[model samples]
Target: MVNINEIARLAGVSRTTVSRALNQSGYVSEKARKKITKVIEETGYVPSEQAKSLRLQRTKVIGVVLPKISTETLGRIVEGIDEILSASGYQILLANSSLNKEKEIAQLKLLESRRVDGIILAATNREETLMQTIRELRVPLIAVGQDLPEVSSVIYDDFNAAKTIMKKMISKGYRRIGFIGVEETDQAVGQFRKQAYLDVMNEENIEIQEGWMQQADFNIQSGEASMEAMLQVCSTRPEAVFAVTDRLAVGAMQTIRKRGLRVPEEIGIAGIGASEISRYVTPPLTTIDYQYEEAGRESARLLLEQLESGKKSVKKSVMNYGLLERDSLI
Candidate 1:
């Protein structure tokens, strides 16, 4: 364990000068900084994170809480966040909430206990508990994907994206279009996308079949199960289905294929969240490009602004959505 004193002695400088040079303090001359850095490299000296944090009153660590880490959209968002945070000399602590409210709250508490400088959350719909916990955190907190009334957030315009997709479907002669999503309380999945679907369907005078509307957790298995159940209602088969996410759409497409149905010919499938996998699927799904990476980058930028400004004002950022047309729907 090489200490600052040893580095100072070896570099033929005082401990105070070494500390200033190592910390990159303004008082240290360029020549001294270069000398100290060279000596540090040769000695294989590692600075004490505890001492550094104690002096700065910050850990230089940012916590990112995500609903699920395995999903493609979330993964891309993390990549974007890492790209910015790493360049700014900050490290990220990833915590997976597993879409569980309790787990998310617990993770936030743990991060606070670790004295993280800030936190970024890709929250679930049922995040009241997490939101309340965030209010008490000494460090700054930013929400991503879902907005909190009193907190800063970066999100896509899910409502407009859904409405646009539904409108496109209706214009393409999809008279009986079904909606597949999660619970209504889920702001992104259930409320925004589902409401847009219903509003557009009603406005177009399209009759929604009772069994065609379904909600479930965002998972491929849930999507498959929901679509399977929808297929059982023989009286009314939807001409097209709009899933809230690419995973659900992929699952629905698999069900359609299994039943000897062809996409766009027998049953069209479309969804939100244009993940990379969406483009590689058998039919190359048609989906709304939610720009999750852009959301992540914007969230990072917002948090950095808060950190630099040392202000607690809430900010809201909305990203644009694009539609990707493919073989899943004509």
Candidate 2:
């Protein structure tokens, strides 16, 4: 694909001159326009939709900012979003934050600079600075996985799902269930989910131990570390360990086996996000199916609707989930 820079070099002009001539904006001399036109005509150089949108003011590109690109959940969500956007004559411009919260704010500005028609943010943490940034953006946008009154969001039923799964573990005779969770800044995955676990334990009259609650980042290595930490601090080990995500649960399983504990016997383990790899893992993981793909499709639809209707009304769409009672949490 030939870019605008190549066209500028061929036309013997600066990039700004080429942009002005192609977009018919700013000031381009007649001689420069003619030269640019000649080069474009000879090379059949077609401007990108983004470049054209800058002039005509309609780009069919949707910017998607994700926490990271390496997870199965992220992959599935992007696939779902792309399916809908591509069918509607639109494309995705992806920006990965690589798990850095600050980068999410930067990606929003970067996407706006590219003149995208709209944006869909798969956010992790909803910091005040990020919310302020979203308010200032001059385009239609929707969020997924985190709810904010100021922004339209498509999120999972984190609290209910956590409570339901904890009840299930208790029903199966697991008295003390340890929790492996992320930081509390992420409202959906970190705060609400952990709060649900604690609430359920309180309701069931189960003893809560400080050592049984461990914090982990969103990764397999962190899960392993958290599980190890929980075991080290707890004089009496919990019968079950519930992690917030499948990646973390898998890591906990690794640590459990290293300690010669048998799953569902000495210790049971579970996680949310019925990720693709969850079914293949040894003693297939028991988890909650958060319907991430559906969330992506819905977020795309909502953003497109807002773009077409020019409606800025804040809409919140909460998604449902299902429990997969697999071998890991029998």
Candidate 3:
């Protein structure tokens, strides 16, 4: 392992200059900084993060808590976060909740105890206990995909996206539209999005079916079960179905095919998230792109800004969504 003295000798700079450039502490001329950077890069001499943290009183590590790491949406968001944070000399400490809501709460405290500079929660729901914990937190926390009072968030326009999707379904002359949703405790995907669908149905005077609304967890298997249950409940089935997520929508498609029904022709289907598999599905899935990755990048920026500037200002940024028209819906 190359030491700071070797780096300084290679760069023809003093040890203090090398220290300032590596630790981002004190000032160094651009020329000296470039030389120091080149030497560090060529020698692959990485400063000890532990010692740096000790001197700066900062870990330079951001904690990220996610409900699950396997989803395309969550993965993309984390990718975006890493794109920005990694370039800025920060590392991510991940905590997976494994689809357990209580674990999400527990991970927050764990990250705090570890003294991570900031935390970004890619959450499913905004529960009361989670909100209370966030409110009491001294460390900066940004909630992604869920809304909580007095907390900084990078949330989607789920309500409007739902409204728009329902409008499209109505315009396509699909009166009876089934909804595959999650637990209402998940305010964004489960409640806000579902409410918008209901409201739009009401506006268009399209009466929803008693068994058309099905609840499922955020997984493909649960979605398949929910669809089967929904069909069993309805004497006359819906002409179309709108699932809260692409994974769920794909699962519904699987069930539809197993039952000898063709998608979009027999039963139109749509979903949100615009997952990578959405386009490759048999008929392709018409879904909403929530720009989740951009949300992650924005959240990282928000957390870093406050951490670097030592400013405590609450910021709630609602990101935009786009309709992805594909063979499934049209």
Candidate 4:
């Protein structure tokens, strides 16, 4: 309950001096700082965060908006973000959109309303309204996982990564290849990755069959259903499959095994996202390691730099991806 004034009086220094010592903003003599510290310790005076925010015009908090919260990719990215921010005396305020486009936009406005210092959006889509909302934000904003226009972003090379995996499959003589993809609303995983698959197949002059390309939700069960659908409809089963995500790949693998098909021998399979479980899955999934944690760390660094410099200049960082050629893909 002791105030700054009482601490100042006890320390035999002005309130301004006490404030400078406490906030480490203005210059305070070492002698005066020592006196203030002693008085504060004895009085057990705790500074008010609200008052500090009002004075400094900063909350020392970053807003992080995630499209979905239950994925391993997101968990790793958040870990990286927190690792960086916590070291610099800042914390994150997380907002989950539950993979809803409308909720995504709403969360942005909600975080802004809370007066967060900045926002890091793990964007799933490049909707016009979403981009417009980002453009209109008063606080600095950065996008991760999607390359968006008119904003600073950290994105994966989804197209190239997909192409790499697909080419690998083709080189191994997988002419009859199937694809499992999510909806194109998620531009990074859906549009870019699918485009790469199509381009590779076209370049190789490989004929894509009916039901070879199946769209599914971002879940294991959806992957299972899509693979089953392909088997039921396609006159000739694909020799191999490329799933846009590792979870989907795992599901497809399960379906293939359940149908008495052998992986890498009868039905080779590969996927993106080098999740932890990818290693333990049967035959070990061949996947693209997108460096998700690095993306999160980089996003935090960019936002912090903007906050420190008081500049909202647009900056873009394209994260690197690597192929983990595993047993799943022969």
Q: Find the 10 residues in a row with the least total lDDT in model 4.
A: 48-57
Ranking by lDDT: 4, 2, 3, 1
**Residues 197-274, candidate 4, lDDT per residue (tens digit)?**
999999998889999999999889999999999999999999999999999999999999999999978999999999
lDDT digits (tens) for residues 114-156 of candidate 3: 7788899987777788888887777898888887777788999
Scored by CA lDDT, what does every candidate get? Answer: 0.83, 0.88, 0.86, 0.90
- Give the runs in model 4 whose Cα sits over 4 Å from its true position: 1-53
- Against the true structure, what is each candidate's TM-score? 0.85, 0.86, 0.84, 0.86
User: Number of clashing residue pairs in every model?
Assistant: 0, 0, 0, 0
RMSD of each: 6.7, 5.0, 7.4, 6.4
Clashing pairs in 3: none
lDDT per residue for candidate 2 within 111-156, as digits (tens), equals 9987788999998888888989999999988999999758999989
Clashing pairs in 2: none
Over 1-330, each residue of candidate 1 has an lDDT whose tens digit, in order, gives 789899898878889998766554436565665666667767768555543443444567899998898988999899888888888878999999898888889999988877678999997764566667888888898888887879999878889999988888987988888778898767877798888988998898777777988876788888888888898874689999999999999888888888888887989989888888898998898898877787888888988898889887799999988999888887
Candidate 2: stretches off by over 4 Å? 1-18, 21-56
Give the 10-residue window scoring lowest on summed lDDT in candidate 2: 47-56
